[model samples]
Target: MKYLVMVQGTQLDYEAMRGKASPHSPAWSEQDVQAMYAHMEAINNDLSETGELVDAQGLAEPAKIRTVTLGDDGKAVITDGPYSETKELMAGYWVLECESLERVTEIADRVTRCPQPEGAPNHPVAIRPIQDGAGDLC
Candidate 1:
């Protein structure tokens, strides 16, 4: 089965790039932001090399969220982004192909331990198994 591990946190997990001097900016030579990106990329590469990664990427800021709600007419009403009131919003996700929940949990632990942007706490990840109707996903 395929599982999607949701990586989310209260503070911005990708905040490492914010306020930090950009490599492109001429005035800033404070730190190496590219190294951070490299770390993130390394995780992706590791998953790809192991053939467990199905798909993965960081999500857009939740503020840009758009949710669909049902109107009185039974039609869907498109509302502004981020319906959830909690500060803990989904920030990114990694989809992995695994045979057991334990395996998925192990991978989740690895991701949770990954170094995130400065000032960001370790994000909580939610794991849910995906259902492909065919059932022969081996």
Candidate 2:
């Protein structure tokens, strides 16, 4: 089965990563960022060596987001930037072909353990099964 594992972050988190501290998050040092990158790279490399990785990617800053919504007139309404009300957005994702949900859960657990600055918020890592065909519906 294939599973999608997602990591989330906020605009404030992104700012902190870029060395701008906000009231909500502390600025990340250069070493902090490199540690995180190394951690994620190790995981990806391991998955690739095991032939379990399908795809993986990290997203750009949320400030560059453009949202498209359905208007009352049935037309597309375009909006810029992240949702004003929602702080958390998907920061990255990995698609893994695993033997079972348990295996994917283990991977997600490791993701949650990624290195970060002290006092940094521990965001939840989401895991969902991917449907390959109509038979997978439940």
Candidate 3:
């Protein structure tokens, strides 16, 4: 089955990495960030070697996002965003072709342990199976 693993974190987490300051801990040293990336890269390499990783990528900061909605006049209304209403944001995702949800969960568990700044809370990775049949759409 193909599954998507959505990596979630708060806006503050992104800002902390960018500004070298974390709300949950002291400023992140350059080495700390590098180490984190190294850990993540190792995971990616493992997954790729196993032929389970389909794709993976991180997103730009939330502030760079734009929200578009249809206005009363039926025109598109665009707004800048950090999506202040929400505390959590999707930071990245991985698409994997795996044997089962159980296997995917195991992978997610590993991701939850990836290095981050001290005091940072463990974030959840939302995992869902991709629909493969027309019946699934209904």
For lDDT, candidate 1 versus 3, the one ahead is: 3
After TM-score superposition, the amount by which residue 85's alpha carbon in candidate 3 deviates from its true location, in angstroms, is 0.6
TM-score of 3: 0.91
Per-prediction tally of clashes? 1, 0, 0
lDDT of 1 at 24: 30
Candidate rank order under lDDT: 2, 3, 1
Cα displacement (Å) at residue 137, model 2: 2.6
Task: Locate the minimum summed-lDDT window of 10 residues in model 3.
Answer: 19-28
For model 1, how does the per-residue alpha-carbon lDDT over 16-129 read when each residue is reduced to its tens digit? 345433333222122434654566688789889989899998877666778998999999999876666667787778889988899889888877766434443445789998
Q: Against the hidden true structure, what lDDT does model 1 obtain? A: 0.69
RMSD in Å for all candidates:
6.1, 1.0, 1.6
Model 1 worst lDDT run, 10 consecutive residues: 21-30
Predicted structure with the largest lDDT when compared to the true one: 2
Residue-wise C-alpha lDDT for candidate 3, range 101-127, written one tens digit per residue: 999999999888887767766778899
Residue pairs with backbone overlap in model 1: 65-81
lDDT of 2 by residue, 1-138 (tens): 999999999888888988988878789999999999999999999999999999999998899899999999999999999889978999999999999999999999999999999888889999999999998885
